[model samples]
Target: MQTIETVVNVTSERQITVQLPPDIPTGEYDIVIVINESVKSEKLAGEKKIKTLKFSAYPVGLVADNFTFRREDLYDR
Candidate 1:
């Protein structure tokens, strides 16, 4: 089984056309289509706001205050 993802433009006449890769054999196969309304609305609006995640740095005291990392520590000597 193979999966291919691609975007298709809908015509004003309410039609959509999809072009499959040449490697896909010429035969009838079961397929599924999913339409994302949220994505369509964002594209029509012409503007989108991106949300970013913010983080605060604090010491949890998981290690000693004077602890340091060394390459040798990664393996048992």
Candidate 2:
């Protein structure tokens, strides 16, 4: 497992884009994107806003829109 860091400017799009590689390894990993300098929330600790996202992405498998699904409404069998 490895950790990658990304940085974006504070103008224009101001967004970070990511894509998975075509060839994926045979294991499980996680991608953690953290914006250290964002003021998009109410801060109680000295005006330092912290946004945390810990996403779980599979290497090679079917992906879903939601983590949990209601099988009664989607499936009959």
Candidate 3:
């Protein structure tokens, strides 16, 4: 018994192709598939939103060159 999990995009209305591992010898095996259209759409929307985000400078007084403290300076001497 072996289990293989992978993601495949649908190229057509009701067709999806999955490539099996070569190690698994050719033979009949149980297959199962689960679809989550809502999740996939949400992921795409989130990616788009992230891409449109605006970039700005850091907070006041936190800019570069202000990081003078060393890693060992956080503890008591």
Single out the weakest 10-residue window by summed lDDT for candidate 1.
65-74
For model 2, the run of ten residues with the poorest summed lDDT: 37-46
Q: In terms of lDDT, which candidate is strongest?
A: 1
Give all candidates' CA lDDT scores. 0.80, 0.60, 0.75
Off by over 4 Å in 3: 37-39, 47-77
Put down candidate 2 lDDT per residue, 9-60, tens digits, no spaces: 4567776556555576667776676777543343444576566798997687
| Model 1 per-residue lDDT tens digits across residues 1-77 | 88777777889998999988899999799998888787788886777665669889886774876665777765678
| Model 3, span 23-60: residue lDDT tens | 98887778777786877888889887645667897768
Instruction: Point out the higher-scoring one by TM-score: 1 or 3.
Output: 1
Clash count for candidate 3 is: 0
lDDT of 2 at 13: 72
Task: Provide the RMSD of all predictions against the true structure, rounded to 1 decimal.
Answer: 7.0, 21.2, 7.2
Q: What ranking emerges by lDDT with the best candidate at the front? A: 1, 3, 2
TM-score (all chains, Cα) for each model: 0.53, 0.25, 0.46
**Residue 69 CA error for candidate 3 (Å)?**
39
> Candidate 3 overall Cα lDDT vs. reference?
0.75
